[model samples]
Every structure is written in C-alpha cells, then in structure tokens.
Target: MFTWNFQYISKARLSSTLKQLNLSAEQGDILIRIHTAIHLADEAVDLARFVKELVPKAVIFGTSCMAVINKGNYALNRCIISVSTFSEATVCSEVIPIMDEYTGTVLPVDMLCGQIKKEFVRDNTKLILTFFSGQYKDAGHFVDRCNDFFPSVPMTGGIASCAQNNQDDFSDDGFVFNEKGWSDRAILVAALSGDKLENLSSFATGARVIGDESEITDTFRNCILSINGKNAS
Candidate 1:
C-alpha cells in the first residue's frame, strides 16, 4: 500500500512525480483523488486523461475546490492530487445523477439516502467517501440523511466549489468527475472494503456561532423559510 500527494504543476511534472513513486501500474491497482481550484477547471479533463495513459487501470475521482488543501497549507489557484495504490484493498464507486428537470430541483434527501444504501451497504465495507456538487442547496440535510442510513460506517468528503470573482454572485460551475465522466449535478459514493485497509477521517471548521440561539421553524426544500417564528432573511 502506498499514498502520495502532489500539487498540480504540469503534465511533465506529474509524470516525474509518478516515476519518483516507483509505482507499478501493471501490478497494483490505483485510486486517485484530485482536488483542484476553479481556475484550473478546464485542465482537469486533460489531467484525468493523462493519468489514465500513465496507469490504464487506475480509477480516478475528483472535484473542484474553492481552495486546495495540502499538508496543513491552503492554496488558491492550485490543485491537490492524492493517489493510493493497493494490492489487498477492494474499492467500488457509484454515481447518481441528482437533477430533476420537471420540478427544477435536485434529488430529494430520502431518495438519495435510499440509493446510497442500496448500492453501498455491505458487511466488509470500512468507509465511504462522498463527492457531491457544491451547487446543491441542501448539502447539510443530505449529509444528515446519509448518516441516518449508515450510522455505523464512517463517511467523509466535500462539496465541489468554483471560483467566484463577484462576492454577490456565487458561480455554480463546480464539478465532480470519475472514470466514467464529470457532472455538476451528481453525487459519487465510493466504498472501500478489506481487512488490510484502515480508514480514518478528521474535520476542522473555522467558524464559531456568536449570535443567540434560534430554532428553524419552517423550511422549503433547501431554503430556510422561517427562524424563531419569523421569516428568515
């Protein structure tokens, strides 16, 4: 088992980095997680293709990040690539499209949870990594619903984010991609299972609640309609 992290440079640099790892694409399977900044979004597809050529059997999964995080350092306009090669671990992933054109809404939380449970629940499964569109309005509710389905299994990941030059207008250009392709309105659930593989997750938030406590009185889909008996701003 081996894992390596790299900041995006160029295709040549990527080749050199992989060569330095001394990994055998022919002998062991590889899983790649790419977190890239919004400015580098256009290059992501090419990068995925390059990695595929380097390792024909590799399974690549990634999403755009508002800022790339690596080794305790945060960077914007950069990319972070994490590759894991394993000979004993079992990995599987499923992608579910979340768009609903009729209602102009994304998938409902209950339905999303049902699909994930149906596809990923297994006795040997150790952990699940989820990558969903950042444009999803109800990310918090989606996570809560996922927890309800697999309370015992650990889950971790982030929502895809894109760069927004205008603070008033948030862009919905973030995307998540895998071996199959990329999508802006989809959720990818990956499961890792095996006795040899151990999964660990940790999270940190920089925000603190300073205002008085308030209760959510009503909600419409992903929107907060009322708080403390008054209309939410």
Candidate 2:
C-alpha cells in the first residue's frame, strides 16, 4: 500500500520552503508540483537545486502550474508538492519527449503512444501523468494518441500557464532517478504492479466545458483557426 501527502511553496521562500519540508532522500518517493512566475529555465534550476539538497533519494516528479493543487484550492504564484511512498508496490517510471529522431514527422499524438508502448512493453502500466507547455505544437495530437494507445491508462496533470500575461506558458514535468541523475519536461509514465498494491487511485479536474461540444473546424500546425465552423480567434 502507498500513502500520499501534499504541500505547497511560493516563490517568496523557495529555498526556505524546501528546507521546511524536511524531506529525506533515504525515505520513500516524493513528487513535487511547482507553480512559478519565473522563466522555464529559472524554474528548472530552482527545482534542481532544491531536489539536490533535500530528499536526494526520493523519486521527485511534478509539473509547473499557474494554479496549484493543495488542500483542494487553486492558488497562484505558489508551488504545490505532493509526496507518496510505497510500501508494497514497486514502481517503474520512464520519460520521453513528444518528438524524437525515430518518430520522423509522425503526428505528435502517435509519437506519445509509440514512446509508451516502447518503454512499458513489459510492465503493467496503469497511469500516465503529464504536464504540457501551453504553447506546444500538436497538443491535441498528443491527447488523441494517448487515447488510442492505452485507453485504460488514465492521464492527469495541468497545462503550464503564464500568470502575468495570461498567455502560453511553458511547463516541464519528469520522472527522476537519483542514482542516474536524469530529468526533463517529457511525458512521465508510472507502472505499478506488485502483490502489495491492492488498490490504485487517481484524480483529475480541469476547466469547465461550456455550451454544446463544438467541433474543431480548422487548424494549422498547433493553432486552431476555426471551431464549429467559426473562427477561434
């Protein structure tokens, strides 16, 4: 069985925030969800620095958000960190980008499923948690690919946002290996299967979908030119 806990930190005391967590690397896995107004590079650097000093051994994974999830409320300019430890189940995780050398001009959606199929070819993958750059190309394509490949692998996580401008935000999430020293903004997949893991639980919430569902009428590359036969923007 696994137990989960959640916490959050703002940009004001990122360093102090990490210290306050009092995480131990020797302990079980810890996932960190960060919300920042800083640039992508800065956010990554701050995260890397904290992860190195605190809980160095835990498997830390999470995405940046405009509004983070903590105690059940959405807040801004803050970072939310969720930690989970496994006592009975063994978890295997992998991260991959939406585009790669082997994919070769394939639709972004197809690329996602292909990566999953390749990495978890043997493990009984149960869930995929991902954070995407709001400006990413082929966002819909990637979602479609996820549905096609592992229809059963429920996906969660938020699209990175730029709070100041309310424009496209770039966010990165990843699965880390303390021993291996690896990290990225790629899709993170977690495969859990062991005699001890008797039950698996997941949660997801998103923006409201108003009015009748409309069809995407026209699109070019990553932008939606039209929806429901009307111009999107």
Candidate 1, lDDT over the whole model: 0.77
Model 2, C-alpha of 164: deviation from truth (Å):
3.3
| Candidate 1 weakest ten by summed lDDT | 164-173
Residue 30, candidate 2: Cα error in Å is 4.1
lDDT per model, in order?
A: 0.77, 0.53
Per-residue CA lDDT of model 2 for 118-195, tens digit only, reads: 766334454555666544566567777767777766665555555544324443332222223333334545555444
Model 2 whole-model lDDT (C-alpha atoms): 0.53
- The model with the greatest TM-score is 1
